[model samples]
Target: MPYAATTGRSIAAVTLIAAAVLPLTGCHHGGGSRPGAPTRPSAAPRPPAPGDRTACTPEMLRFHARGVRHPAHRMLLTVTNYSDRPCDFAAQPYPLLRLGPGQRAVTPAIGPSDPGTVITLAPDATAYAAVTTAADGASGRGERISQFGVALAPHTAPGQVGLDSGPPVRVNPRTARVTYWQSRREAALKW
Candidate 1:
């Protein structure tokens, strides 16, 4: 019958159209446990790149100094990972001591430890460095350290920070020292 033939043609045309359009809509089979379950958009975070990640830039790292402790004479310099992806930092970070606002940069007499290893910082994780100064205030000793500035690398420009936000850490010109960067806060805090 002509009517039956027309219905067959219509069914064939619709099948062809669906076959062409389904793939365009990103429809795929077997995405779920079931053989034909529909797959929804994934809410998972993007996977981190395999192997070693990139070095931390100034933007990715945030500087934090938890209140200074007396007697111990050591300040924990926390570098928080603000980035979504894991990043690397050198084993030792050289500190550029600023005595006052707009004062000449004073490099610590002691440099970072040698054979620097790469430190991986996960998102929201922190790396720490121990800043040791004379238990007696480095103040009135001619060089009064007010702020600490750190760079991404030994050769990079110093990252800017506010010296007045927290208690100012004074470093004795002759005795100030900074430990190599450490993954664990406890390890870096050790004298």
Candidate 2:
């Protein structure tokens, strides 16, 4: 009975030592534990913010110009939406004529102050505008410029001038994807 008791105590001691040592064997501090080991939780992955959307493109542009009997020029511009979604847009006037060495281009001295106009375009829809330029009574005849320059209001940003025209310019809204078509021949403007 005495020998059996001693054997039992020895077994218990071995079991206790093993319990303590086994955990330590597998326990690595992940890195060298000199001082102040970093205990910060691993950074959680985050999703992109709402402002990370792609920009819109101008699908179509057209211009028409006409010379009137009273020394005035009239221009009509059409912009088409080629994207799957609707787009809001505005216009910026760009002079089409380059003044020659002796020639001068006349623009209205007191014209409309507003340069931007907002329009919505449904997928495949077109927006049009009419611009009139009055001549300043001067001397010789000058060459008439035909082309009118303008750009898409949104260009590719979100804001007051952003393109929110329809359903937020989504991708492939229905059957056809958004696309654009411009006039093949350039229209002339008489001076």
Candidate 3:
């Protein structure tokens, strides 16, 4: 009986070892299958299912503003998921604006809409928001905008990103509007 118990434990330990090793070996890591002795290909690792993924951290998300040439004056605010997992943005994220040398957070004239359709950003995937500096060609003649302030969470002060490093972008602030984040660039650019 004593021998049987020890054997059982040994078998379990070996099983755990094999479980770890087989995947590595099957991928041609274990001496190349004894010089091509009928080697079998290993399956590629599967990504975690949608439900198994976690929310994106501030570090995992990247923000960029691409200028759009139009009379209305617009920019595409892009948020990219750089992490290995998928993430969801349940509601529209508000952007904090900083302008001139003061670098104060000025709320844009536009407001974000409530939760729209759920958007899931896969790793390296991008979502877009439309930023309009001027609603019309003749409007906002006196408003000046320097840089947008990044905020990781709602109502949080200054995000990890540095938007003020670049040259200031002057625009008519009165008509400026930012649409809610959208899965498609077209949707964000609609307004």
Candidate 4:
């Protein structure tokens, strides 16, 4: 018994279609429901081209601080590039923020411990750091502070400047900490 020419062609077409569709069924886009599962990662921003890169200095950036809505002791810190060119926020993986004297104000890092890939901010762009202050009850309402100090990542002359807080904040030395500078505000707070 033999098949007609059109029937043979139809079978071949079906085979080809099945082969193409089967492979795609195993593939996924954006990790649909399981965000934690591995998927094609979003493209990361390209690094600054060679010599064009500059370190973001205190003068090049305008810093701001305010309390976070949740987690009562947290503060949201942001630095916006006020310069004419793009710059990298590079250093010990986080911003140097001090709210009190000596070692007492040191905000323990909650993210990368060492300097990693620098987060580049184009002119007018901004970066963020989430600072979790010490618990109030633990410190019996830690030192009341209305301002905090901010320093540039890499050592820069006039390394630090004091930025005013919208309201005085209390921080205890025991548990206060800060996250590494993140490209997004939500990312800074996520930690």
For each candidate, give its TM-score against the true structure. Answer: 0.57, 0.32, 0.56, 0.62
Sort the predicted structures by TM-score, highest score first.
4, 1, 3, 2
lDDT of 3 by residue, 77-176 (tens): 7889988878866533544444234434454535444235667788899987777766566443635554456554556565533332345445554446
User: Which residues of candidate 3, in runs, are more than 4 Å off?
Assistant: 1-54, 91-115, 137-146, 160-168
- Report the C-alpha lDDT of model 4 over 1-191, residue by residue, as the tens digit: 35798899999999999987665565544324343656665699666567665777777888877777676677888889988888886544578766677554456788552336688888999988888787556746568666767666535322443445466667765678888888888777776
Cα lDDT tens digits for candidate 2, 1-191? 69999999999999999987665554474443324545656699555454333223434333233333332333333555666665454232221221222322322212232233334456677644333432343222343333322333323321112221222211111111111222211221221
TM-score of 2: 0.32
Whole-model lDDT per candidate: 0.63, 0.36, 0.62, 0.71
Stretches off by above 4 angstroms in model 4 are 1-52, 102-105, 112-116, 135-139, 154-166
Clashing pairs in 4: none
Tens digits of lDDT, candidate 1, 148-188: 56666655667665443566655554556666667887767
- List residue ranges in candidate 2 displaced over 4 A: 1-56, 60-72, 90-117, 136-141, 153-191
TM-score of 1: 0.57
Candidate 2 lDDT at 45 equals 52
Superposed on all Cα atoms, the candidates' RMSDs to the truth, in angstroms, are 6.8, 15.2, 11.7, 16.7
Highest TM-score against the true fold, candidate = 4
Total backbone clashes of model 3? 0
Among all windows of ten consecutive residues in candidate 4, which has the lowest summed lDDT? 154-163
Most accurate candidate by lDDT: 4
